[model samples]
Target chain A: FFQISPAPSYANPGIMQETISVNDVKDAHKNWCNALLAISKAHSEGGLAKSKPLASEIIDAAYAYQFGPVAFKPTWAYGKKTFRTTKDGALSYFIGDNPKFNDPGFGIGSPGNKDYPNLKNRSPWVKCTPENFAIQIFGNTAIGMGWVHFEAADGYKSKVDKTLSYIRDDEGNLRITVHHSSTPYSW
Target chain B: FFQISPAPSYANPGIMQETISVNDVKDAHKNWCNALLAISKAHSEGGLAKSKPLASEIIDAAYAYQFGPVAFKPTWAYGKKTFRTTKDGALSYFIGDNPKFNDPGFGIGSPGNKDYPNLKNRSPWVKCTPENFAIQIFGNTAIGMGWVHFEAADGYKSKVDKTLSYIRDDEGNLRITVHHSSTPYSW
Candidate 1:
């Protein structure tokens, strides 16, 4: 019997043919972001936001697992401390805010755990990029773990092990939530 | 600049304190039965071959390349075939002759030209279990592309993109070898 979790590699854009084109990478990333955006949208609005809710649902699940379920609130910083609401009311942060989201042990060079206090204590999640290599996909889970290229407070470029987890609820959909990463100051 | 490839979740094994065991899966019947063993060792070769003939010498100097500079030569297979003196004998099927050897392909997958006719064939060399994943060190002559896992056949299991190239003088002394994969497969 096939396992329960769905395979992310074969999402809407899976490798049907044996040949892997460069576009496959970009498409997969787009699919991944789309998956996340769905969830992010749901957390912001009660209206049905399409299949994207899966991503939001997973995020809520992570919050349920980490902070209390109440913490599932959605917040996106577009820039440093400078934040504003969009037409749809999604909070976007443009200013660079501490990635810890307010975790007490903000930068402890560890894959943050619930024990870290609040999301603020968590490692900052970076917007996904191509440099982050896709490592493995197990069963229905596609695990993309890589060294997030970021600058250390000391002005040095540091790579941290950033992990993103994607999963689906009872309904068939793709979602990404639950991130664990470490930075230099994380210790 | 990220000089090092990010290690997998299983890299520090210490990162995740767990005692996980896996029951082996059945194998796919491949040519010469040598690729099977190559894949096996790859499973535990700590990523890349501990040592190998410098990819430069192997590609530019290996007399084997004198014909075409093959992409996916099994490391040991290259060593043995190059000697031909019956001194350092058969370590792989490609080195030893099976009816498949005469199949008009340069090696087992000689028609490999079909997949990678231009030295860009994703799979440059092949190996069996014990070596498990096929390693292809592609640098086009730089630090070298190391440890890439491509979805391989035999039931779509991800194969380690590991393969080595070697070069020997009148007397074999591993002229210039390099190791590319800094981490192991996550799955």
Candidate 2:
């Protein structure tokens, strides 16, 4: 006989709605970092052959998490005019045709090829070190804020603060509804 | 006799959860502008006695909308290291010791006294013109993005982009959860 799932308890309504655990949050962040590293390595190594898969994985995750969809426009604050609302726009910022602020000579696209359709060139993000991670969880909703130090392939490094807001789907998968990032101000 | 609210529809769970009408959103924005105008007028007219009540009204609305008792921190980004999380902090940004960027000669707090405890400065914001307002509502949560142009008492003008995220409380009152604002980048 097929096993029947336990009925949802009415005693605590919070229990019924809450599904994501601390582990889930941790895992998501870990996976994200891993993906970034992998993409960097792939771009430096085999170029498009290796990196495309990782980029595809990120796009898949974006869809699964409902980012850049109609409900969630994933506002990205790279610059005044470069506020990206779509997934493609975000991809463009990270590993697309956009020129890097620090080094305008070196663009932000794939490692070796700037014209590569799906994230060419190795815009190497060597490390993703996060500091002061503050996570707040409410009923089926959560927000994570942290300062991240990113080491680039060209020995360039910068610190940026990030705020990510989430909402759990009906099937209990936590999806990001808002993602905002900005470089720390310096006089 | 007591009237029970209708059961949530199984056909479309999203529709079932969405309770706010388009009118409610419009009214909220209108009231917000009105309150801002009132506060500016009160500050200019009578200082502490006049402006304190308007500030308290905003605070009460914040509480009613579930902003910053615990779950909501209401992170407001005015500038670098100028993130105001508390109600008092936000007020400080508007009409407190923080000097306005465009008009450095004139401060934001009480006109005659910078020591005015509760928003003493007659920092008259002559106009609050919002452009490109994009408001997205889902269920009990919403986000509004726009560009706001502020004209100071001395005809000094500055434009800042703003993002406001909101959530409806258990009592069906809309409250701001996140408010981020930054001046346009200048090369």
Candidate 3:
């Protein structure tokens, strides 16, 4: 279900043999995509009494300072290196090619990879407010979506959809796992 | 707000000099103890958020692997060493500590360092899972926690919580900044 680098000399290993398929696309996408979904589910599925802890947990994990530098993007530096981010601006990165300049959403592929990066040239940086997220969890699986109305440093603003997935470990216990995301576009 | 191992010397460079206050403890212990109520609001405020994409990005950043070795534990007679992930029959390390381990909750504290014995015995091991986490963020301060429940090497099972903290960067953004963890404990 995972890969390493494009290095020519890197050897192939079959440790994580579970491949992503229609059967597993849901599970394989667990940890990454599901966590996003779980948060939403935790809110909507439970009562205020129940959801409070869930909400607090979500807030604590997402906004905690412990995430430190590795969890952040130095947009200015990222722009210098990958031309994907801006300095004190909006988040920008597309999964496609030549997206419309005026388009509100971002792309998620080199024209086509997976999911719905329906636009181009913009970033899929979702402005996730605590209010916009929708979350759900299944046996050994979880999913979520948080909408962010953020404008990139370049001033590209849109209601971004942040998709998420989750999976359980070998013990058959599900956790926030996969996170698959694509910004919505109005082409 | 803090630095990592190998604490720096040279007086910390005194970025700013200011006076602080402290109080004595007066609580239910039948003695006088000091309670904290916002002694100094100057350091920085904690951060807050409902959901984050740090883990998602980490997963997306993870390279897919088709083939690789297990790099098994030590052994000379075994010849050609290969990688090995104890995915099979793996139980939680907290089993011995909490026999009633029925819940999917993570026990906080580092493994060793005299805090928790369950974790002390298992050095260099960290729990990994897919679950919701949260953090506190302020003007220039933050802290967080992430958890995922799973089975360990035997019949043991438990949840893993990876807690972290950090200070804001010059640009007023929080990065992974700093990471500290808890011992993998049972329910």
Report, for every candidate in turn, its global Cα lDDT versus the true structure.
0.28, 0.50, 0.29
The DockQ figures for the candidates are: 0.02, 0.13, 0.05
CAPRI quality level assigned to candidate 2 from its DockQ score = incorrect
DockQ of candidate model 3: 0.05
How many residue pairs clash in all the candidates, one count each?
73, 9, 106
Please write out the lDDT profile of model 2 over residues B7-104, one tens digit for every residue.
Answer: 65687343334465555565565555566667777777877566766666775685332344222222233233344455555555444544532111
Fnat of candidate 1: 0.00
TM-score of each prediction: 0.23, 0.66, 0.20
TM-score for candidate 3 (chain B) = 0.24
Off by over 4 Å in 3: A1-25, A28-49, A55-183, B1-187
Q: Pick the candidate with the highest DockQ.
A: 2
Query: Which is better, 2 or 3, measured by DockQ?
Result: 2
lDDT, residue A128, model 3: 27
Put down candidate 3 lDDT per residue, B20-96, tens digits, no spaces.
Answer: 11110001100100000010111012211101122122211221112222222211111221221221100111111
Q: For candidate 2, lDDT tens digit of each residue in A1-187? A: 1223466567733333355555565555555556667767776686655665556567556433343332222223324433445554545444443453221111132234433233233456777765534554555655555555667776667565555566667666556565555544332
Q: What are the per-residue Cα lDDT tens digits for candidate 3 across A15-45?
A: 4222333334343333222333443344335
User: Which one wins on lDDT?
Assistant: 2
What's the candidate order when arranged by decreasing lDDT? 2, 3, 1
Error of 2 at B15 (Å): 12
